[model samples]
Target: MRIVIAEDAVLLRAGLVRLLTEAGHEVVADVDTAEGLLKAVEQHEPDFALVDVRLPPTFTDEGIRAAVLVRSQHPRIAVLVLSQYVEERYAAELIASRRDGLGYLLKDRVADVDQFLESVGTVGAGGTVLDPEVVSQLLVRSRHRQDLELLSPREHEVLGLMAQGLSNASIAANLFLTESSVEKHIRSVFTKLGLAHEDGGNRRVRAVLRYLGYPDPGPGHPSSAHPSHQEFRP
Candidate 1:
């Protein structure tokens, strides 16, 4: 895959470039600042962009903001954010626009070279990949929400895997169940969450994440009304 990297740290930036290069992926452009990252994306139009959540100047959320801009302007270019800390808000915002072709991984994950490369390839192919830490954080926040209470213990397990962008096959393997059984659990999850089951696209992904409050409701998109605890049938 052709890639663009945005990292403020010199050693980390060089390491990423070397890693990708050795892995046979082309590093089309590498930049240290968020502004430069945006310009590099606009110029190279790489298939994937590996960004850090913190960048130069403020060093708060510049990389994330630039990533959002890339998604808005270059929808086809996938973004994978590598951060030192698992900031739930940043993860939520990154996945808010669309679930597919997005990733948020903690910096420590890079040590697992094989898995890290796999994640990059997955996101490059229009898949979602969230750090296990991020998934845990989102799950904790959602657990107290009224809608999430509708899920059974098993269903909650399935939902957590779903939020990790795992396919039914993967969730089935991890949970020691048949793929069909996983599908059934997913359907039940969608029903309990009041999300429509569509024949195609990432509807399930969107539903699970949105229910966890990842998708910020923009203008004209009112927030979903959480059903009363008594109203939950599941």
Candidate 2:
């Protein structure tokens, strides 16, 4: 897939370029600053962009701001953020009622190369991919939310995995439950949360956003089939 990368760390940026290049995907551009990333994406119009939370100059929210801008200006380009810190506020803003082709993975939490590649593919293919730590942090902050409190423990597990952008089958494998059981739990979540949308993917995104305190962007955008939770062991 065509791609652009934005990270200030030279070694890490080079490693990402080399890693992705060797894996047979083309790296159209790799830049050190958020401006460079935006320019590269606009110039190459890559299928997706892999960004860091921080970037040059300020080393603070530059990369994320660029990411949000890319989404706004070029809705077709998917985004995956890799950050050393959680940056909960930026995460929520980036999510902003959209889940597909979006990801937020903690840099230190990316334990395996293969898993990282899996997540890359997930976001590239328009699937959601949140780091489990990101999911936990987002959820913990919303535990007192009324809609969230309606979930059963099993439903909550399913909800978290769903927020992580796992397919029903993947969630089943992770939880050691049957796929049917996973579907049932997901259905219950929708019922309890009042997200009775016609599209399954829409409902999934809505549930995730509801817990995160964002509303669905609109109706009818299809959700992508999720990849396995590869960053950690089941």
- Candidate 1: TM-score? 0.63
What digit string (tens of lDDT, one per residue) describes model 1 on residues 75-170? 999999999998888887888888889999999999999999999999999999999999987775565366778988999998888766677888
Off by over 4 Å in 1: 147-234
lDDT by residue (1-234, candidate 2, tens digit) is 999999889998898998888888999999999999988987999998999999989898999999999998998889999999788789988998478899999997455789999999989999999988778767755653777888999998888887776788899999999999998998888888776656555667667766555434444643222323222222
Q: When superposed on Cα atoms, how far off is each prediction in RMSD? A: 15.8, 16.1
lDDT of 2: 0.82
Residue 181 accuracy (lDDT) in model 1:
97
Per-residue lDDT value at 5 in model 1: 98
| Backbone clashes, candidate 2 | 0
Error in Å for residue 226 of model 2: 42
Q: What's model 2's TM-score?
A: 0.62
